[model samples]
Target: MLTALKLTAFGVVDESTLELGPGLTALTGETGAGKTMIVSGLGHLLGARADAGIVRRGAPRAVVEGRWEVGDGIAGRVREFGGDVDDGELVTLRQVSAQGRSRAVVGGAGVPVSTLADLVGEFATIHGQSGQIRLSNPDRQRELLDEHARPAELARYRADFAERRAAAHELAELESEAMARAREADMLRFGLDEIAAVDPLPGEDDALAAEQAKLMDLDELRELAAAAHEALSGNENDYDAMGVVGLTGTARKSMTRLSDRDEAAAPLTARATELAMLAADLAADVAGYIDDLVADPLRLEAVSGRRAALATLTRKYGATVDEVLAWAASGAARLAELDGSDSRIFELRDRIAGLDSSLAADAAAISAARHRAAGELAAAVKTELAALAMPHAELRFDVSDAQLGPHGADRIELLFSANPGSEPAPLGKVASGGELSRVRLALEVVLATGGEGHTFVFDEVDAGVGGAVGLEIGRRLQRLAEKSQVIVVTHLAQVAAFADAHFVVAKASDGQVTTSGVRSLTHDERAAELARMMGGESDSDSGLSHARDLLARAGRG
Candidate 1:
């Protein structure tokens, strides 16, 4: 709920501060007294477009500030934007410079103007002439009915509709790209077949390289093996030549005799025996290696051919045989997926079909609920219109089948008749400006039932209305304020009299310039203002007497 509004250098309002309270607060003045300026200031404070022209003549800028008793929904949003909110109280400021620049502040922190707009929208609704026109829109009509009827069902249906749309879109793309998918699958299959034919094994490439190197240097390898064998054991062709084994045997026999005479020599004898045994083992292994070192040209040719084959596989699929094997594994897996595209497409189609059936059922339920609510809403609004002095006014909701949409499969339109004999027609066709205002108020009153803690600002919603009709508008507004905060900008004395609080906008002029200011009225002051609103002299006894009677009727005297 709005608690206060302050304006400075804004249009004709040079400086004004309004202290607001619960229930209804009426703002009134003469046609040129700048009541519109108050509405403009409130609009700017709530994040409306700022026009530099709104700045008072010769002023640098126009500033609009407002305070609201907000709930956690708004308070949490303020904090999200790094603003400060104290004890559920929120402050907003909008400043428009004469140079066409604008600035907005919320809860003492700077923010984007839209942020302020969104936060205020959660708790406050501003209805003016434009809002009346908006009511004529078919979509808005549907929204009103949904708000009155089947909100939960509509939400669920929309969710399902969204899911169905996404699935259908995917299915379309998959079907359209069937040829591309098939081409990809063929490419993968060919690559897999090529890799499979090579039949490469892990580490096979490295093993083959080593074997080829050995074959290339077959003579050198054999000579090296022969030398190692002769070093470990004496050559049979040179019987007199001693090698490591013969020398260690001679040393062991000498150490054994010395060790028998002296104990220190015993350790040398054991070392000689160990050296001789190691030399014998080395000699036997070298002989075996020499025997196996025969060079065969046929084996060399075969190893070279096999290495070339492995190289071809590596060049195409990987850098080595192991990498080639890895690619084949991954390729097989991908081929399987590509091969399964038909099944996947089939599955998607089945899922989409199932969702379509489910959505149809959901839409039917929503349509049924809307039809039921259409009657209830029409009845409720009709009753409200009766109280608003539209005794012959009739309202009806026309719910008809439409193609399934995100909202549902129902199209809702409001039909109205202002007299008993006239056939109801679309709201825009039949209702005049005054009738629209009452109808708008009636719909709001019905929809806003139990909507506590919300603020409703009606900018001359009672425009083009007067007399007892105006009084009825005021009574309904007061009734609306029973559950929400209501602020009305009205010129009607009857409406002004019903206000729990009243403010009057008055203008003054010097020889060169004019400015307006607003002030809350005392009980006696309200009487004088109401008299002026009734087109009578403020000091006239008859006007004052009538104003007092209005206040008494409004229960505000």
Candidate 2:
């Protein structure tokens, strides 16, 4: 519940502090006395959008602060933002600079403005003139009925409805693009067939290239090997000409004779013996190479042809054999999906059909609930109307069959008849302004039943109403306040007479500036204010008499 509200440099309100408490509190004033500014300030404190124009003409910024007696839920949320809550109390502040910059603070810690908006709904509900206008909308009527009737069931129905709609849309799109998808499938299949015909293995392209290179240089390779072996050993057919083996053997004999005279020559003899054995091996290898060397042009041609086939795949698919293989794998997966689209279309049709059948049943069930709840809600509103000085008014929640939609398969309309013998018609066409005000109030009172220990603020709820209707509106607000805190901004003295706490917003001018301030009224002061609100001078003897009579009638004289 809101405990207090303070406004500084806001609108015509230069500085004002309104101390509030439980039960009905009324703020009343003359026209343009800034009664609505209080509600506007309250809105700012609850994270409404900022407007630099709301700042007083000479002030740089406008500030609004509210103190609340909160619960552990709100306290825990405040702590989540590293804020402190003293006992059960929390303070919220909003500031708007003349440059349109805004800031919000909750429990002394800075927070996003939306944070206050999210948390405010847990403790307060504000109804303003816009709410009255919204009541005439049929969609808003259906929403209100659903909120009161079966919120959980309707939520489930809406979820299924959304899923069914999505599936239907997907099915339609798939059917519409059937030709395009077929073309895509054909292109993919051609690619896949070309790849399959090549039957290229991973790394096969590189292996073929290496084998082809070796085959292309076969003659040169054989010649190079023969020459290298010859350099290491002379021709074996000319052994008498003394190849390296014969020469090294002769040198070893000389070194062996020298080693007999000197030990240092022994190492030279071992090296010469190793050189002679290597020379003998090399001469045998060179003779084998001369015998093994042969040219086969047919094998080389076949190798080159295979390399060309693999090259074709590499050019079309990837830069390498491995990459081409990867493309084939990826294309196969994509082709599978493309080929499966027809089956998926069938699956979607079945899915959408199943969901539609289920949603039909759900919508029927929701309509049934609305019908049942309609009777209860109408009866409740009728009772509230009777208390609000409309003893003969009839309000009906007309639920009729309609096409299935997000809300349900029922059309909800609020029908009203202000006279006893009149037939009820749609509320928008049949209700007068005053009747609408009373009816709107009645619905609010009925729907607001379970909001105990919370705060309800009403701005201009008594608009287009006066006399006994105003009195009854005041009475109902008082009754509502019995369970929850109620605050009303009104021009009706009859309504102001019923408040447990009354504050008068008065505008004053010092020749150059106009400012509004709110002051709590004493019993005597309340009478004077009420008299002034009743269109009579405060000091008039007759007005004072009537004001006192009104207060006494409210049991507060």
Top TM-score hit: 2
Scored by CA lDDT, what does every candidate get? 0.87, 0.88
Per-candidate count of clashing residue pairs (backbone under 3 Å): 0, 0
* Model 2 spans > 4 angstroms off: 14-16, 44-52, 55-64, 73-86, 90-118, 221-298, 339-347, 508-515, 539-542
Q: What residue pairs clash in candidate 1, if any at all?
A: none
Task: Identify the candidate with maximal lDDT.
Answer: 2
Candidate 2 lDDT over 349-400, as tens digits, reads 8888888888888888888889888999999999989887889999998999
In candidate 2, the residue pairs with backbone N, CA or C atoms under 3 Å apart (3 or more residues apart, or in different chains) clash, namely none
What's the residue-level lDDT of 91 in candidate 2?
A: 94
Give the TM-score comparing model 1 with the true structure, all chains together. Answer: 0.72
Q: Could you tell me every candidate's TM-score relative to the true structure? A: 0.72, 0.82
Local accuracy of candidate 1 as per-residue lDDT tens digits, 1-557? 89988999999888889889999999998889998887777777668887888998999999999999988877888988899889989999999999979999999999888887887777888777787998899998998898888456667777878888887887888889889988988887887788778777789989989998998997999898888777778787998888888888888888889999999888888998898888888888888888888888999999899899888888888898888888888888887877787888898889888878888888888888888889999999999899888888999999999998888887888999999999999998889998998899889888887678898888988877899988888888898899899999998898888889998888999977888988889998889999988999888999999999999999997
- Candidate 2: global Cα-lDDT? 0.88
Total clashes, candidate 1?
A: 0
